[model samples]
Target: MTIKAVVFDFGGVLIDWSPEYVYRQLIPDEAERRWFLTHVCAMDWVVRQDGGQPIAEGTAELIAKFPEHEVLIRAFYERWQEMIGGVLDEGAATVEKLDAAGVPLFGLTNWSAETFPYAWETFPILRRFKDIVVSGRVKLVKPDPAIFHEMASRIEPHLPGIEPHEIVFIDDNRKNADAAAALGWHGVHHTSAAATEARLRELGLPV
Candidate 1:
């Protein structure tokens, strides 16, 4: 079937979100790096931020847990900005191609509300999307069908004639992409902009 829309994941796909980018900058000492990753990274406190916990509250909770490393904890919370650079120009160009070809575009990401505005500011191309579903604002994360269902619901009203399978969801996380595929949407595990463009081309969409 011809794809009607393409959904993108922001972090690993459009923007550079390498944790090491921030860790190397903040924790210069190898010992401190290992310690921070072991105690803090493993906790996955960012999940709370994505799960609708306020940034201030989440940062405070993390600080309380690691009272001795308050500065490190704060740095970790603010490190998202450091990790984010401008969108991949090639990816932005591909999105433009897809849009010009009449394929609807949307963003489905597990991003915090606190960071979304910054992303919008950094990537002006994002405004071209018809819709965006951010986990922090919705209070639901991906791989949980609720978020997918919410996205489907929002697009369904706009595309009453389209089938669920017509929406191609592109995400870097295999689990989330698999979950979306299982729910009857077309899923693409994004490896690279080139690879994704190839897949879209296969679907008869110009990318």
Candidate 2:
């Protein structure tokens, strides 16, 4: 089927999101870093926060779990702004090209609501997309079919004549790309913007 919409994952695709960068910046001491990562940097805490749990509550729960590191935990949660950065210019340009071609653009990202505005401000190109389905806003993170379905529902309505298969989903993570592919959408495991643009051209999409 011909491509209709091009859905992009924000983190790792548009913007570089590395937890290690944050870890290194915040927890400079090697011994302290190990402890914080093992005990305090809880995935559940991140999930709960993304699921719309109050930040204070998530921080408090984490603090309660690891009382010794409560100060660092609070600092990490509060100073999230120091971690995130902007999207690369070349990638942003590619997205702009796709948008200009009348290809419906959308974002399906596992991004925190608290940090999205920071990302948006940093990457001005994000404003061009027709729709943005964030996991934090929807409370459904990807690798889960429901998040993909949620995105599909929102995108399908916008492209009235197009089927779900016509949407091309791109992400840096193989699992996410594969999940999208399994759902009958075109999925690209992003390596470089040049390669991705070539793939779009192969699909007869005006990149």
Candidate 3:
């Protein structure tokens, strides 16, 4: 089947998000900042929150391990909006084109349930999506086939009888893109808005 829909990954693709965005100001020294984020508030540890653990609970767990960094740990979730710079204009424009072309657009993102609302409020472009599957809400993260399947199944309500292979998935992570391809979906390893839009165009998408 020809690609009939586009599935997007939020951070790094459509919107910019990074612990560094928050930590840089808090922990001025680059080395200490990297150490704090890696050893204390690791992405692996943070992903548990993305997998549905409450942000407060996740922070407490980290605080237990690194009590000295309690305030920094708290800031991870408390000021997460600082991590999001804004929407990527290139990606946003592509989405707008796809939306205007009447293509079904959906989102699959590994965002904290507690913090995702901030993104929803901060970025108006996200509202264009027909549906969004948040990892925190669903307890599933990308590079896991289950989340991809979940997105596929959920989108059925809007685009009935749609096949996974007929959807084009775009993500900044190569592993996530690989996982989507494993399911026979056309995967676009997004690097920049221009490159991603080119890939979408190559896939015969409206963008």
Task: Pick out the ten consecutive residues of candidate 3 with the lowest summed lDDT.
Answer: 198-207
- Candidate 2 lDDT over 100-176, as tens digits, reads 88888999988778768778777778888889998888888877889999998898778876776788999988888
Query: Which has the better TM-score: candidate 2, or candidate 3?
Result: 3
Highest-scoring model, lDDT: 3
Give the whole-model CA lDDT for all candidates, comma-separated: 0.82, 0.81, 0.89
lDDT, candidate 3, at 80: 81
Task: List TM-score per model, in order.
Answer: 0.92, 0.88, 0.96
- In the range 1-207, model 3's lDDT, one tens digit per residue, is 478789999999889888888888899999999898888888899889899998778878889988988899999888887888898888898899999999989999998888889899989999999999999999999889999999998788887888877899999999999999999999889988888888777778777
Q: How good is model 3 by TM-score? A: 0.96
lDDT at 124, model 1? 79
Worst 10 residues of 1 by lDDT: 39-48
Candidate 1 local lDDT, 1-207, one digit each (tens): 678878888877777676667888878998988888777864367777887889899888878887988887787667768877668777778888888888888989998888888888878788878899999999999889999988887787668877877988988889989999999988889888899889888877887
Residue 142 local lDDT, model 1: 88
Q: Is candidate 1 or candidate 3 better by lDDT?
A: 3
Q: What local lDDT score does residue 11 receive in model 3, on the 0 to 100 scale?
A: 92
